[model samples]
Target: MAGTSLAGWLLLAIYLPTIHGLRLAQMGTMSPNGGDDGVDFRPAYHITPPSNWMNDPNGLMERDGIFHVFFQFNPSAPIWGAPHWGHVASRDLAHWQRLPVALSPEETYDIDGVFSGSATVLPDGDPVIMYTGTSRRQELGFFWQVQALARPENGSDPLLQRWVKDPRNPVIEDAPPRGTNFQFRDPQTAWRQEVGEELGSLWLTTIGSQVSCVGAAPMYASRDFVKWEFFGYLHSQPGVVPSENETECTFGETQFGAEGRNWEVVCYFPKRVGEEVIHIFKYSDQIRGRTPFGRDWYVLSDVPLAFTNKTVPGQGNALTPSLRGAPFAPAIIDHGDIYASKFFNTSSGRLLWMGWSFETSTGCTGTCSDGTPLTDARGWQGLQTIPREVQVDLETGQLLMTPIGEVEALRSAQLFEQGGMKLVPGARRALPLKFPKGGSGGRQMDVSATFKLSDEASAEVSSTGFKVGVAVTHGRTGALTSVFLNGSLSAGGGGVEELEMWVDRSATGGATSANLQGGRVTLGGVAKEVTLRLLVDRSVVEAVGQGGRVRATSRVYPAGRGDWGLELFNEGAAGSVVAGVEAWEMEGAFVDDLW
Candidate 1:
C-alpha cells in the first residue's frame, strides 16, 4: 500500500547557518509551490520538522509555561536514518519553537538509535523518560533491544534541554519471558499503584509479539518506576502471518509502528464517564479483507476489576483483562490514516489523544509495492493528527473522539457559507459560486455541513441510501477523486442506518494519481441526519462526523491544475437531500521560522 508521486524533486546544495539562540537547526531550499500547484503539499496547520523526516508525537508534556513535543526524527536526511529525539516547545500548541536535540545515540547501548519513548512529570517536578534502545556492540557482539531512561540536564530550564542518559541504562535489561521475538519497546505512562506506597506507581510497557505469527501485545509492569517485571497481555489478534522473506516492511516500525498494526503496538488509555469506568485499547489491524491494507486499526474495552490503585504485582486490569473479555469488539478510532496513538493528561486539566498520521507514504504502507520513494517536495514526512479529546459516550456505549477546541484557533477567515441548499438525485454543483469558475483553489480550508434526506425521498433513502460528497479538489477533465460520505440502505424493514465514508481515488476519474488509496468508515446507520466537520489541507483531508462519532482522513495529490476545483456532489434522485454548509480558508500554523 506504499504510494509515490513525482513531486518535482529539486536538488538542493544550500546550507544555512543556525539561527541565533537555537542549539540544533538545519533547513533546505524549499519551493514556493511544493508541487506544480500553487499549494504546497505540506500541512498548513499540522506539525512537521523544519527539514528532513518526523514520525510519532513522542514525549508530549505540557508543564510550567511551555509545552514539550518530542518526536522520532532523522536530522541527517529527508529519508529515515539514525533516529534522534528531535525537540520543540510551544506555549500554545499551534506555534512551536525549535529546541536542541533532546536525545541522541552516543552511548554503546544506543549507538544504533535513540528510539520512541514517553514522558512522566512527578508531583515534585522534572520529567522521567523510558525509551527503547537498539545496539550492536563490539563486546555484546550482536544486535539487540533494551529499555533505557533519561532526564533533563537542567530540570529547572523549563525548556527541558540537554538530556542525560541513565548510566544504569537498559533498566528492563531482559527480554519477555514468552518467546515473543525482539518485540519489546514503547513504554506507557505509569500511574501510582500500591495501597499506601506513594512512589509505587503501576507501569506497563508493551512489546510486539506473535503467537504462531499472530500479533499480540505483551505488557511489562514496574512498581518503583525503575525496577520492572513482566506483566500479562492486554489483547491479541489471532491470524497474522508476517511475510517470511520480505524485508521492506520496516518503515515507521516504531517511529510510527505502521508495520505492526496488523498485530502490534498496543496503546491503552483509561477514562471514567459518569459512574462507568472505561478502558480504551488500540492497535493496528489488517485482517486481509476486514480492513483496508494501508490504514491503522483501533479498538476499545472495559477496564477489568474496576481498576484499583493497589500496588500488588500483576493486579492492574491492564495485566488481567483480555481485550476479548470486553463488552464488544474493537472499533476504529479514526477512519483516517491514524495509528500508534498515545493518550495522556495535560497540565491544562484535559486528557488528549494524539497519533501519527501516515500522511505521506513511502516504500510500503501495510503491503509493499516496487520500492521507490515519493517525489513530492512535501519536504517532511509524517505528522501528528490533530489532538483529540477522548471520552466515553455513555449514550452510545462507545468512545467519543473530537478534535480539541484549540484546533479552531487556527482558522483565519470565513471563506463561504450557505444557509441551505437543495440537492436532486444525481445532481452536482460547483461550490463557491463566489469564484464563478468553481474555486480559485482554497487548498487549505475547513468545511462544516449538515445533510437531511428530503421528506419526499424517504423511500429512496431507505432503499438506495443517498450520497452527499464534497470534491475538496477535483479536476477539469471531469475526473473525480472526491470523498463520499453516504448512508443507510435498508433490506426490508426493522433496518439499521449508517453513515459510511469512502475516498474515491481511482486515477481514471481524475484529481489524484491512482496510486493514492482510499477506504470506507461506516459511521453506523443514520436515521435522517449526518453532521460533518472536515479539515482540508493542501494534500490531506480529515473528516469528523457528528463530533467524531466517526472519523476519516487521507493524503491525496492533485493530478491537474483544474483539479483544484471544489464542488458539491449528490447521488440518488434530484432534490433528494438538503444541506446547510459553511467553509473557511485556514491559515498556516508554522510561519515564524523559529529555527
Candidate 2:
C-alpha cells in the first residue's frame, strides 16, 4: 500500500531539497496556540504534519527522555504518494516539535517509497529501525517489498533527526515460501530470547501476509540483526462472510481480494495483569461489515502460556511455545476511522496506542463551496488519533482503552457544566455557553456526560430500546452530528442489558457521514448509568463509553461553520436524565509556520 507510481516519485524528487529540510527546519518552536493558517478543519491538539500527507505512526520509541515519532509522509503533496519518513520529537506528550525528514526513497531497493516498520533498542542500548523497502524488480518489471534495517546517524543525538540506512540492506531479501511477495510488509519489533544451546539469543519478528486466502503473520528469526531464518506463524485465521450489505461488495472480487484474506501490520506483545500474563495479537484488515472499511483488529490469547525468558524443554524457546499456535478469534478495536495502530510501552509502565485517522472521502482538490481551501488544498491530509492508554480486564479479558491523562493539560477553563438536567420524550433543549476569545469556533472540545433512563423498566420491556442523545450543531445551517446511547435487553436469550453508543452524522453532510457506526457492551441487566467522554477536533470525534470499555471515532464536516452549539434530546418513548455534563475548550498542540 505504500508504493506509489514512478512518475509521482520523480515529481516529488524535484522538490526534495525544499521539502526535506530547508522549510521545516526554519520553524523555530511550537507554542500551544500559535501558527495556524485559519483552516477550520485542521485539528488543534492532534498530531499532524506541518504540510503535505501523513499516515501510519512508524518506529515509535522513547529515547533519552524524548519521544520520537516517525510516520509515513509525502512532503511533495497532500495526497498519498512518494512517501518519506517525516520526523517529530516531544518531551511532554501534549506538545510537539517538527524535525527534518528522517528517511527517503533514495536507494536502489527503496526507490519507490520508505514504508512502515518498528523500532527497538539494541543490546548496546542504541535504537534501530526495521522497515519495509519497496522497489521495482527489474527481472519481473513489477514492484516488490523486502525487509530492511536503519540506524540513527549519531546515536548520541537525543532527537534522532538523521538516520543512515544499513549497508546490509534488505536483511531479509525474499518472502518465506507460503507468503505472498507484495503482501508482506510492516515488520513488528523483534524480541530476543535464548533458543537452543547452539543458537543463542535469536531475534524474532513477524511479517503480515496471506496464504491460501487466509491471513497470517509469519515469524522470522535472526541470530544477529542481519542473517534471518523462517519460523512458524504467530497467528492465522480465515475471513468470515460479512452479514451486512450497506455498500458495494468488493472483498470477494478482483477489486479487493479473495473472500477471507486479512493481512496488514502485525503487532504481538505480552502484558501482565494481576497474577496472570496474557498475550495480545493485533492486525489490520478491510473486512466488509466487521470493520466495514480499514480498521484495527485484535485477538487476546486467553490461555496461559509461559512468558519467561528461560528455555522450554519441549519447545525450542520460551517465546515460541507462548506465541505459536495462538487461536484467532479476533475483534474490532475501534469502530470508527482509526487504523494501522502501533503500540509502545513507556518507561513508566504505560502501554500506549496510536493510530492513523485517514480522511473518509476523496477530499476536495481546490476549494470548498464556501470558497475556503479544503484540508487537502491547504497542503495537509491526515492527523493522528490522541494516544490511548490500553489495558486488559482481568476477569473478562476485554480491552479498556482511554485517552492518556496527559491530554488533560490541553483543556482550558471549563466552558459549560451542568447536572440534573432532564428531557421528556421527543424534546430538545439548548445548553447556553460562552467561548474563549479567539477560540476555534467549537472545533476543539473535551466533553463528558452521563445519561440514564428515567424509566428503566419501560426500556427493558420495549423491543426497540431507549436512546438519549447529545447533538453538536452549527446554529446557522442547522447541520449537526449526534452521539447517542441506546440501552436494551439482550437478544441472545440471556436477560443481560446491552448498552450501545452510536454516532449519526447524516445531517453533517460530508464524506465521513456515509458510515453510521456503533459499538456495544453487555451490562448484566441491572446496570445503572451510562457515562461518555467525547474528544472533538473539527472533523474528528472520538467517544469513550462505559469507562473506555467501548469506543467509536468518526469524522464529520458540517455544511456551514461558526461557533458550535450543544443540544440534549431524548429519542426513545421514555424520558432520560443528564446527570452531569462538562465541556472545555482545548488548546492547540503545535505552532509551526509550514502551514
Candidate 3:
C-alpha cells in the first residue's frame, strides 16, 4: 500500500507538470521541457467537424477575454456514452481551441455520466457550474437529476485547470422518489434577487414529467448556489394534450411588457406532436409561487411565437415587447434531424444557440459503432451544426436565426462571381468561376445564389423536386457535388422548391454520398417564390430554403483545385426559369465577436 501510494504521488507529480506545460504552450510560451510547442487550434466555422459525438453545449461562459464552451461528448467511441464535458476556448467566436476534457464521471454519484448543464459567475465572484447527474442502482433503477456548486479549483493561476465538484451535489434533486412518476433534470442557473432578498439567489428551470405525460418545465429558486427550493410549475398546457413525449433544454428570462404592465416567460422546448417534431412556445401573465394558482394563471395558451426579443435586464431572456405580434412566423432553426437546442447570451450581446446535429437513426442506434461505414453508408449522419446567432422579429414575435456574423471572418478571398443566369426548360449550363490568388486552392468554398423562378417554370416541377450541382476542377478529373430537395410541397402539393446547398471540395469524387461527406441542408417546403442562402466550407454545408421548411445540414467535399461551376437541374423534368443569382465571399475568424 505504501509503495502504491508513492507511485500514485509520483504520477501526480509528473502529470500535473505536463498538464501545466501544455497550458503554457497554448499561451504562446515555451514549455519548461525546452520545446517550442504552441498549439494553433481554431473553431470550425462551416459545420463542427466530427471530433466525436457531441450533444448539447454546456458551461458557455466568457472570462478575461476568453470564451469557454463545454459540450456533452463521448470521446472513447464515435457515438455517445460514458459522457464527459469536453472543453474548448475561443478568443473570438470564430476561432476555437480544443482543451482537455473539463469534467468526467469520476465520482460514484455521476457514474453513469455527467449530462447537460450551465456555467455562471457565482455571487462570490467565482466560476461555478451546474449539471445533471445520471446514475443507476438495482433498487432505484435508472435515476438522474440536477446538481451544482462552485468549481473545486478556482483561482487566478492559469496553470490550475482542474474543477472540483461541490461536496453537497444533486443540489436540486427533489423529484418524488424513483417510481413516483415525476422525473426532474436539466438545471439552468442565473443570479437574480430582489434588493432585500439574498444576493446570490438563483432561478433554475428544468424539465419535469408526471407519468404518462412529458415535459412540464418546473421552476426552482436557489440561494448559496447549493440548496434549492421548489418555486412552482413555470408553464404548462394541461388540456393541450402532449403527444407522448416533450422536453425543454432551457428557459429564457421573464420579460416585462411596456412600462411593466405585463409579464411573459420565454421557454423553448421540443414537442413530438403527432408525427411532427415541432419547436413550440407558451406565454404567462402571472408568476406562481410554490403553490398552484388559479386557472387565470394558466390563461396563456400554447401559441406559435416568433424569435424576437428586446434587450433588457434579467440576463438575455426571450421575453420582449418590441417584437410582439408581428407577421413573423416561427422559423425552424434547423431543418435536418437536429433537436434539443439551448440559447445563451454572449459577453458581446449576441444570442448564440447550440444543439445536437445528427441523423435520426444515429441517435436511435445508441452507439456510433460504425464510424467508417456510417460515414460511407449513412452519408450525412452524426455531426453538429455551427452555432448560430438568434434574433426575434420586431413585428411578428417569431424567431429568426442564422450563422453568426463573425464566421464570415474566415473567408480568405473571393473565388468567383456570376451576375445573370436564366434557367430554361430542358437546358442546363455551368457558370465557371476562378478562385482569388493566394487563397486556399485546395480548401473548399461556400457557394450561394438567390434567384426568382417564373410562374410558368414553377408549374412544371413537383413542390419538393429540384437539384443543384457544383463542380470544381483545375480543368479535368475534378469533382461533382449535387444537392437534392424532395417532398417539399404543401398538403395540396404545388410550389417552387427553393435550393440552398453546402458542398465540400475534399470529398467531391469520393464514394460517400454528397449529403453525408461535408454537406449540410437548410430547406423549406414549396412556396410561390422565395430567397435562398447556401454556405459551404471545408467540412460542412448549410442551406436555408423558403420560409416554410428548412433542411439544416449535410456533408460533402471537393477533390482538388480546379475550375468551379454551378449547375441547376429539374428533377421532375418540369423546366423552371431562373431570374438572378449572387454569391458572396465568406470570412473566418479566430473567435466569435459577440458585438
Mind giving the per-residue lDDT tens digits that candidate 2 earns over 1-595?
2333443553444334344233334442221222222355667798887667888899888876888788988776667775788877777678777777788887778888888999988778799999988887677665577888999999988888778899989898766554556667899888775556666667888887654445657778887788887765665543223322222222233113435564678788777877666677788876544434576887776455332332111122222322234433566788888778888877787888888887664333211211123443344667888888999875454778899998998898677998888777777888886788888767799988887555544334543356777788854677788888887533322332667888887777644445577777644335556777889897789988877878888777654446787888787754445557898999988644222
Cα lDDT tens digits, model 1, 1-595, are 0001111110111122123102222332233322342234657677766555666667878778677778877654555655678777777776666766777776777777777778878777778888878775556453456778998888888788678888878887665443332455566665554323444446556654433233565566776567876655555543122333222122223323323332444566666656655666666544444334534455555545333332222223343333435445556677656656677777766678877765434333432212124422334456677778876665455666777787777776677788568777887877762332333367677788777665444454445565787766554666555666676545334332555766666642322335433334444444556667778776677777665777766666554554355677788542356777788766667634433
- Model 3 vs. true fold: TM: 0.62
RMSD of 2: 7.3
Superior by lDDT: candidate 1 or candidate 3: 1
lDDT of each candidate versus the true structure: 0.59, 0.69, 0.45
The model with the greater TM-score, 1 or 2, is 2
Give the root-mean-square deviation of each candidate in angstroms. Answer: 7.5, 7.3, 12.5
Best by TM-score: 2
- Candidate 3 lDDT, tens digit per residue, 150-229? 38375683322457788887676665221111144445545353323333334444433331132234455555557776
Candidate 2 vs candidate 3: the lDDT winner is 2
TM-scores for the candidates: 0.79, 0.83, 0.62
Task: Please give the distance, in angstroms, between residue 58's alpha carbon in candidate 3 and its true position after superposition.
Answer: 1.5
